[model samples]
Target: MQEQANLNRRNFIRISALTGGGLVLGFNYFLTSCSTSQDGGQVIELNAFVKIDTKGRVTIMSPNPEVGQGVKTSLPMLVAEELDVDWKEIKIEQAGLDTVNYKRQVAGGSGSVRESWESFRKVGATARQMLISAAAAAWGVPAAECATENGHVVYKGKKKTYGELVEQAAKLPVPENVAVKPATAFRIIGQRTRNVDNHAIVTGQYKYGIDTKREGMLYATIIRPPAFGMTLESLDDAEAKRSPGVQQVLRFDNKIAVLGRSTWEVMQAAKKVKPQWKEDGTLESTADYTEKLHGILAKKPEDKPRRQDGNIGQAFAKAAKVIELAFDAPFLAHNTMEPMNFFAHVTADGAELYGPIQTPERARGRIAELLKLPEEKISVMMTRMGGGFGRRLMTDFVEEAAMVSRLAGNVPVNVIWSREDDMTGGFYRPMCSYRYKAALNGNNELVAWHHHSAGVSGGGASPDSFPAGAVPNFQVDAHTYKSPVTTAPWRGPTHNYIAFSEQSFLDEIARQAGKDPVALRLELLEQARANPVGKVNYEPDRFAAVIKKAAEIGGWGKSKGENIFQGFAAHFSFASYVAQVAEVEKQADGKLKLKKIYCVVDCGTVVNPSGAETQVEGSIIDGIGHAMYAELTLTNGRPDQSNFHNYRMIRMREAPAVEIHFIQSSVAPTGLGEPCLPPAGAALANAVFAASGVRLLDQPFIKSGLFA
Candidate 1:
């Protein structure tokens, strides 16, 4: 019923004439439609974000930024599906930040499609209605008798192309209460469609933010503080200013910008400037931060409980068996393939920003405040991004470009971050640790759950996320330790680090009870289904489906060849459920090799199978790679791992093969960007234990003595 309400929500569409001749339709974020006449001293021109020409060329303006999540292709599929037009007849174009016509333009939180699903559907359906009415009126037939197929209005034995009647459609009254095609009737959707940008991407013609080129633009890079808790006290740019390609050396709050004719030249010139740094606060190392987190978990009465259900203490006292475990994870970097970059041309007239940003509207708002300009004066154009696992959600790079351009008398400039600058710049996935305890009765049935976590910031899930609702007695407490370091959202921020801890700890309970890990999970899930304890967030059947599918695909609990070890994990997030079965081969010398991972996702409808498979593959690679070899440590408040060489990304030779399966359903679509990632670490760690009997309690599994 809720999905129907979302699908049937009414929206206003205004139709007007195109510049030459043809039809154009646009929509407002508001519930009611306004006139085609001018309002608020600006002409919206019928609010037309979609324009169709006399030649049957349909063009759509995709409002969200593309961060390689395939929104550029997937979002358009929604529009084309309802527009009832031949897929080849329509063209997709990226839209700039337009607050008047678009809403929720950010790309983080795996929400591009989940949030915009209804709006895109309405946009296309409204346009389709307008065209059909025009064709019906021309043929002198009742509009009810006419239906659209392949961009044409058909009746009995006659048909008319939409292009032939689009002009007349622009003059008709705007349609009300538009109805969209049902999922079963979809043509363009549920098809194996490749990304529209695939050709350009493969051919190297896609213009990423780092590839931005403007007329007379200066290539700029910045020199940041050496570490956290430090600030630039003084700088002498006498030598740097003398460089042949150096255009200017400017300083802003805590950063120095060196602008030159080219990227390579500015990077080299910036190093020549000498500067003295001063400690603004106490300098701490990785060990200090780790110890602080441990102290919080050990004892912190002042911290309030995040959640509580029943009496965990009483349940533990009555338990015949108890399993306790501690898990730790380190800070991580985004390491986007393309270094952080943005181009800003801030002139007295207005500010123009062009770059790859997950949140273009956010960047525009920040630039407006920085330049002291009206919101309407700023225009932001989004380019394709090489990679942004939540890093691009920060507008710091965009702000620097605007500030640099403003400092240099409104000269156009492109700002780029060096690889080292990106890693040590301080927005890390905060270091954290988890302590879990489960109480089991004499019957070996689970009864209680206790979780205490402490981190530099709140990056993990609260107690209410999962098993909390299944356990009769549960307690959760969270604490934070303040530091000079900054933290922001990483991929699947809450679940990314905690899933490993949560799921692996469940396995520890399974070991203590002498039950199969998958059996224990299914039993608990059945308990939750029969009688949930608290606020339950997921559909039990849907969640269980993925687990069963993945296990079946990986042949869980079946006899295996010698040296083969398998592990299983499942998690739910972002309105999606995922399960993975990871396999590893144990060698004679006591080393383990990752062989393959079987993954299954229930994210409702899969918009594009190709894109969905790619997202799962990428997420698994990212999750396993980070768990196996990635870590960031600090010495004197400065990151010791500066780049890939030291950061230790997963190499091609070490990456495991992934097989994916998605549950086909008629339910409304959800997101795929981050759901499949959270469970990867747990499945891999459990497999490691099965192969080498090494329980990995720490991240960068290699550091946990898995290799030794």
Candidate 2:
């Protein structure tokens, strides 16, 4: 019933005239359809998303959180484009959590532009139509005679600004249906535009969640258990409380918190308090886990079949040659730059929380339940995030802050996690192992393929990955091992490891068949396009488009000045297709050096070309960094690496030169955040093989001894 009410409210728009003659147009989530103002009634909803002042300044609310993905700027560009207003005259405002007015306020899945493209444009076009109608009616002319251009209604030789017509426009009824501009008529979109918050970001004026400040706010640091599945047996905070600047030390369910007047004092005092914990002894060491994974793969366990087609046993029996290989990837941490921090002020009536959360609505509900308060009384505000990737999707940090505040006499408290705390935290990407087997006929034609993956619980391979529909007899099976460590989505999720294994295996298959890598993929794509097996999720033609474009632009087979070798790989994810080619060279000290990378993407209509390009570039660099050096090992069920010094990142000197190209099409836009990341690790591995005769079957290629 509540869902129906929200859906019904989305159909109508309300225009309220302010005392200064300003016009505020927004979605109406309450009140009846009548426009008449009643006695002392609040006709306008508080969730006004758009406002046009008498000075001709337009303000558009950004409904989603800005986690350095450029949604704050790109979303408003969509509104300004259809509103027929100059981008310079518009201001962007970050919106608070209001599910009734704004729908799906999220930043993950890269769906910001793809999902909100049509609805935001409709809102802008409707406002423009109402203003034009008012101008035409005042001039005693038909509405069709007046058209909006740049912020004015022009008919014949006379023109009036939108400010002049807003007063009368607010009194007019909204049109049911308004015409939106076509793709060809787009002027502000598809153009390179700077970020709206770039100046504030570079000037150190942008306020991130970690930079949030409030009156009488206290700082807190948590001392968590050393290992997974551990229980706090005893905590000694007598010395911690007596330390300088320390106010109090509180014990929670699984951790102890030290609250103080300053962050440094809390951090310093937190280390002095010693906590003893008892482990459940359910977690295995890293070496034991690796051996257990191999054992699981060797045994014929009960198969959880994801996809199966044709007779795989018969095809393998008739094969002339067969190839089998196994691959593994370690657990990974998000390690966001800002760490995890949230401010909470819980009162007797309600609770207020502020932080850089990816899902504000979900957080609000969870906090409300935790505080034992009504959902309507709780509020969650989103702040700019230093980085989210996929860490902010979890609300554990938010819940901790609220719990701390509630336990501390409902005083405002801000909980902050240090770099070490975040690194040793739970919710890392699950470790995975993949085993693959392939058979070929006498004519060197692929006949059958089998894939089986084993991983920690909640991690599995994509059944619809490449070679699924391309092979005659294909099957994918999965097995899971239960453990106490928590795991969640990290960027591309399962596709990240799946692409590395599948693409690299394809390159090896091409070499064994005495065929070019790119040619072999194209042939398989052609086969899938000609006679696709059961429901193929990807468009074969679009998949082949990026492959051909990348090869053409990258000069696939061309020489790259001596010692430089190139490699190519492609994959499709998040409804977008991307292909990448990497170039590498061997250094004198027996080390591999990345030179350059060429990429081709087909994500449908480009909203902001500049921002899209940055996403692709960043993904490539991030993928390379993880493939080269990022890995989290375990000892006694605890993370071995803590800070950046041990879990190194790729520096600027090690970053490769990147060149990107996008396919031109009129289709709807898809996400760019994760689609370009899957193939980068495989592409770099393939390039290393070309430069030096080594086949890397595992990740963290630097430790695989390719250079040694």
Q: Rate the local accuracy (lDDT) of all candidates.
A: 0.84, 0.83
Candidate 2, 284-319: lDDT as tens digits:
667777887888889774765788888778998988
Residue 556 accuracy (lDDT) in model 2: 94
Model 2: which residue pairs collide?
none
TM-score to native of every candidate shown: 0.95, 0.95
Give the Cα error of residue 60 in candidate 1, in Å. Answer: 1.5
Q: Compute the lDDT for candidate 2.
A: 0.83
On a 0 to 1 TM-score scale, where does candidate 2 land against the true structure? 0.95
> Where does model 1 exceed 4 Å of error?
1-20, 28-48, 705-708
